[model samples]
Target: MKRISAVIVNWNDKETLARCIRSLQQQTHGDIEIIVSDNASSDGSQAMVKEQFHETFLIENPDNLGFGTAVNRGFERASGDYLIFLNNDLEFAPDSFAILVDALESVPGIGAVIPKILYSQKQNAINSLGVNIHCTGIAYPRMLDEPDCDDLAPEEVACGGIFMMRREVYEELGGFDEDLFLYHEDHDLSWRIRLAGWRLLTNPRAVFHHRYHFNKGKMKYYHSEKNRLHLLLKYLELKSLVLLAPPLLLVELAQWAHSLMHGWFFLKLKSYGDLLDLLPRILVKRRRLQSRRAVADREIARLFSSDLQISGVQSLALDFFLNPLLKAYWLWIRRYL
Candidate 1:
């Protein structure tokens, strides 16, 4: 049996980290090593891991170094055939690791496998199955709140968080981009993985529960908006970027308008404000990313779905006037339309 190394990055969430560790201990896959990389968390996270789960490896960093950097630090210490990047706020089903491993091994071309993730609060709801990109370089969770089942089947995509990767692929393509402080790092990694001629899959047989802290507010919105723009500037081909420019600009304008109307003017301001502050850095990163482009424009184009569209008015109005009806409409669209 191939050994699997599980790397969980934690920062101040001791309770969630404990639950995650318990789930790791219960994994059916016995040939596994667990590593907890704590980013100088002041909330006793390091102490709790050291005192409670001494058998598991722990890396206590001297200071907070952001998510991607901490994961890269953990990857250096891992010694397994496969590496599993798990969130601290997640708990896996007993066979989660085994099932993901089985799927990746069965499909020789697959570089990464993501398990079906359901929301812990809403038992029947999903967190994410896989991730997909639209033509404009916007990416979203494929199946966000659907029931967990084997119905989706195995499919390929750009990437999925809470996924496992072969050790060889990790070494070849390199680990997570450290510059990405938080959001869009997984998407960036997935895009690179696909460009390197490896596939990503989602295995429904493996299950996990996620605590979707929907009320995270502005911090979430900031990272999401900033990293999204950074990703487009980094990997998207110039031709595709030009084609997507109009819709992208429209989306940004709509977002700013909505934020202003909803009393989130500061939130909108910070997103663009940060974008300007980071523009020089973004340009430097973009140059580096373009230099390493092994995959052609056509190959990258195949990863996106042309049918996806983002209408500003419809999206903004639906949240205010008809959420339930809109939910039903989406269900119908996803089911039959």
Candidate 2:
């Protein structure tokens, strides 16, 4: 049997981490090595892992190195054929790892597999099957906060928090983009994986429970907006950009309007400023990624979803006004790709 290394990056969330560790210990797949990569958490998370889950490997960083970097640290130490990147705020079903591994191994050219994630408290509500990115570079889980829809198909991106990937593929792709730090890292990595001619799958047989919560803070909005724009600037082909320019501009306008209305105008402006400052460096990375792309821009374009799914109270103005326009614009431009 192939060994599986599960890495969980955590910061100041010890109680949930303990629950996550317990679930991993109960996995049916016995050759699993669990590693807890703590980001200098001050909540005694490191001590809990050291004492309570003594069998699990623990990496205590000197400071908070962010999610992607800390996970990379765990990836370097991993000796398994497959790697499972999981969030500390989750509980895996006994066969979750087994199911994901089986799906990945059975498929040709599949680099990763994500399980159906349901809310820990609301079992009937789906957290995510996987992830998808909109044409405007908004990454989201379609089933987030929605009742189970039974839509179990392959996805454009794997959910960031919990997914399994082949070790060799991950290494070849250089793992997650650390610059993203928190948000859209999965979308960016999965986009690269697809560009490298590897398919991603969603396995319904596998299951996990997430204690998911949507953050409304300025930092959350800032990283999301900034990284999304960064993703587009880096990977979106110039031709596609030319064709989609009008809609993209409109999306930006709408974003600005929404932010202003919601009192996040300054944060939104900060994201744009940061994006401008990082443009040159992002372009360099773009050249590197584009040079390595095994697929055409059009092929990558197909993976993006037409609709953007946001998890929060639905805005009547957005639903009745903005979304229809956005959907129509996407459908029109997608054919060109």
Candidate 3:
């Protein structure tokens, strides 16, 4: 039996971390190791873990390293053949780890697996079954707030908040891009995984309950918008990028207009500014990734979903008009890819 390690990243969310730890401890898989990577949380979470769950390996960082970095740090000390990266605010079903591990081992080419995630407050409703990306680089959670279903197919991106991957896969991929820090880290990593010809599957037999609520946070907007553009520049082949330029520009305009109305115009502008600053470094990394890509851009483009599934933010024009147009555009340009 392959041992599994759960690396839970936390920052000031002590109570939620406790619940997450308890759930992990309840896993039916006895060889599972629990690793708590605290990001310099001031909420006395370190002491709580040391006193209450001292058996669990704990890494108390001196400063608040970002989410991906902290998880990577915890993983450095992990001793299991399989690794589960997770947020602090989640509860795993008793058999979740078992189900995920079984799926990973049973599949031949799968690189990672994420369980169906349901909303903690509304357990009957689905939170995510991993993430999906649009051709324009927009990534959103699949099945957000929708009724739970048993569609256990493969996905474009594993939900970064919680998922299991083999130790070799994690190490080979070089772990999460620390620059992503919070948002879209999963999309970036999963995209690379797909580019390397590894399929990602979501196993319905396992479930994770997440305490998630959507809010229009400024910092959230910052990283999400910036990292998305970064992905476009880094992953998409130049030919594909040129072909998609018009729609991409239109999306930017729409975002600018939407941001102006919603009090986030500066953030929209700032994301572009930040993208410019990071361009040279990003393109260098792009060359590295592009050279390693085993899958063609056109083949990979098929993984992108046509439907737009942004959560919590609603707009009449967006819902009724823009989405269909974008879908049409994707359908048309995708043939070219």
Clash number by candidate, in order? 0, 0, 0
Q: RMSD in angstroms, candidate 1?
A: 5.2
lDDT of 3 by residue, 1-337 (tens): 8999889989998899999999998999989899999999998899999989978999998898888889899999999999988888889889989999998998899888878899899858988887878887888887777887666565545334367888888888899887666788778878877888887888877988889878678778778889989888999999999999987887787778877887888888888888898888898989999899899888888768888756556888888988999898888988887
Model 1, 1-337: lDDT tens digits are: 9999988999999999999999899999989899999999999988899899988899998888888888898999999999988789898889889988888888888889988889999968887888867654556677776676657787777668778999998898779887778887888888888777788888888888888775446566667777788778777767666655655765576567767765666866787778888888878867876777777656666656543433223463545533344334333332221
Estimate TM-scores for all models: 0.86, 0.95, 0.96
lDDT scores in order? 0.78, 0.83, 0.84
Q: Highest TM-score among the candidates is held by which one?
A: 3
Model 2 regions lying over 4 Å from their true place: 149-161
Report the lDDT of model 2 for residue 131: 80
Q: Flag regions of model 1 displaced more than 4 Å.
A: 263-270, 276-281, 305-337
lDDT of 3 at 253: 79
| TM-score of decoy 3 | 0.96
Off by over 4 Å in 3: 149-161
- The candidates, ranked best first by TM-score, are 3, 2, 1
Question: Taking the tens digit of each residue's C-alpha lDDT, what string does model 2 give over 1-337?
Answer: 9999999999999999999999999999979999999999998999888889878999998998888888899998899999988888899879888888888888888888878899988858888878867778877785676776555665545334367889988999998888888888777778888888887778877888888887887688788899988988988888888877876787788788778877889999999888998898899999998888898878777767777656553677667776788888878877777
After the best TM-score superposition of candidate 2, give how far the Cα of residue 158 lies from its true spot, in angstroms. Answer: 7.5
